[model samples]
Target: MVKWIVKFRNERSHLWAKVVMAIHSGGRSFTTIPIKNSISGVWKNIVQLGKGSSLKLSDVQNRLEVKMGCGDKIFFWLDKWVGDYSLKDRFPDLFAVQTDKFCLVQQRYSLTNGEIVWSWGGESPATHTDMAETWAECVKLLEGVKIEKKSDMWLWKQEDKQEVFKVSDLRSELDGMDLIPET
Candidate 1:
């Protein structure tokens, strides 16, 4: 999706990329051509191809590691980001004391003098004994973080260390799965 136009060229150099992009962006429908009610078998197959992968739960969970660029999409508490664990798991006490458990990465942290801090500004639960320790730990992790002006990238934490999502990689993953042949 980062380079949708150039990336989707086929063997014949036909630019079906637009159609593919539209399918992904426009609710996986026949958006390249206006469709009132019905869909063609070809379109159905195309849509099915996109949804046909049988990803395992562990594999799916492993894939949610977001490469935080600007902290736009990654959920702060719920997602696994830092130290191979979610904030909710790492700091259970803090999560229990948190005002908003569903906050994004950007919401829970703030940049102060080029250092990231665990800040809920108005009413931080730092007064509590347990929360103070949790805040300290969070601050430790946050201080090491470096955010740049870039889009947040949701990555699969499998063999893709570079964090680029590829359909071929998913196909390869599916190929390894043992399946009964259709008669």
Candidate 2:
């Protein structure tokens, strides 16, 4: 599941991933595809794995954070591009008010006269103190980010030096967990 997801994100030209994405979600980000809409067993399973609230899925998902480069493909609120947590999880109040939940990091900001101008989704900025404070923090978090002219990449958080995903590593980690119970 993780392999397929990684392929979908990293290897855009991969035949299997391309075919699955073409048929299942019509080239949309796999994560954005609603589980209810999925028809194929593999597609359904993939969506469930990505969206599931299970501890196993959550733990694995957290390790696969996006490293922003171009920022076109990385989701602003949904993907963990800013820090360890997604903006949605970090600032639920601001997320609740966002106009586009699935907006890209590139869409949230613009290069205006050599300065970065952030535009959070909404008709107008939040006025409520709680949301306002959350908005400020979110902006501050992004102040240091500068999108470069390279494709977005995913980093496996567990791997310190390599920053690469290995099936063996994942297998070992899963094996270490108490997956099977004595009956």
Candidate 3:
């Protein structure tokens, strides 16, 4: 239900966007982007359920895989667009010296008439000692990727590539994970 609501948060109705902002923001608006502990009446119960439940919101987010088309919607460093990790998470040393961490995949990469070009924010991380090695691997990893003109989507990684997200599938996947510590 939360993912369904969030999927329509930006593209659908104005009221839905407002509600999403309220709920996802934890009642706090633009002022506090990361802080929790403050939730409005509408989402207080949901937040509480998340806290008491075995599956966490962060866990679900970590398992999400993005199908990039234009790449405008997905964050470059923050979102998990690659196989299993975000670029920042996959390459922390290189990310530390990055010129523009916020640059989206669309901005950093482009396809011109069948040719794929990666701009990489036009900066080379010369300061890092492992820059040469990491950059080469990063380049090779990005070489196969291309940006097509289509809508992006957040796919549940537990399902097949063509499969649509089902709450049952997500629940089962989450249930399979070890939520309790064994002594």
- lDDT per residue as tens, model 3, 84-143: 777877888777666666555777766768888765453664545567777778878887
Give candidates' CA RMSD values in order. 9.9, 5.0, 6.1
Candidate order, lDDT descending: 2, 3, 1
For model 1 the local lDDT of residue 166 reads 71
For model 2 the local lDDT of residue 149 reads 78
TM-score of 3: 0.60
lDDT of 2 by residue, 1-183 (tens): 666666566764468655665566433333533233646587668656645533355566666766678787677887777777778788877877777776778788888898888886965677778777778888999998877879888766674643667678767776776756779
Better by lDDT, candidate 3 or 2: 2
| Number of residue pairs clashing in candidate 1, backbone atoms closer than 3 angstroms, sequence gap of 3 or more or interchain | 0
Q: Who is ahead in lDDT, 1 or 2?
A: 2
Model 2, backbone clash pairs (residues 3+ apart or across chains), number: 0
| Top lDDT model | 2
Task: Give the per-residue lDDT of model 1 (tens digit) for 1-183.
Answer: 112211331111234634543444333221212222344545445334333445533345455456678676556776776777777778777766566554667776667797666675324648777677667778788677768677576655556364566767666767887776668
Residue 23 error for model 3, in Å? Answer: 13
Which whole-number lDDT from 0 to 100 does residue 36 have in model 1? 23
Number of the top TM-score candidate: 2
Model 3: per-residue Cα lDDT at residue 75: 62
Error of 2 at 173 (Å): 6.5
Worst 10 residues of 2 by lDDT: 26-35
Clashing pairs in 2: none
- Give TM per candidate: 0.61, 0.68, 0.60
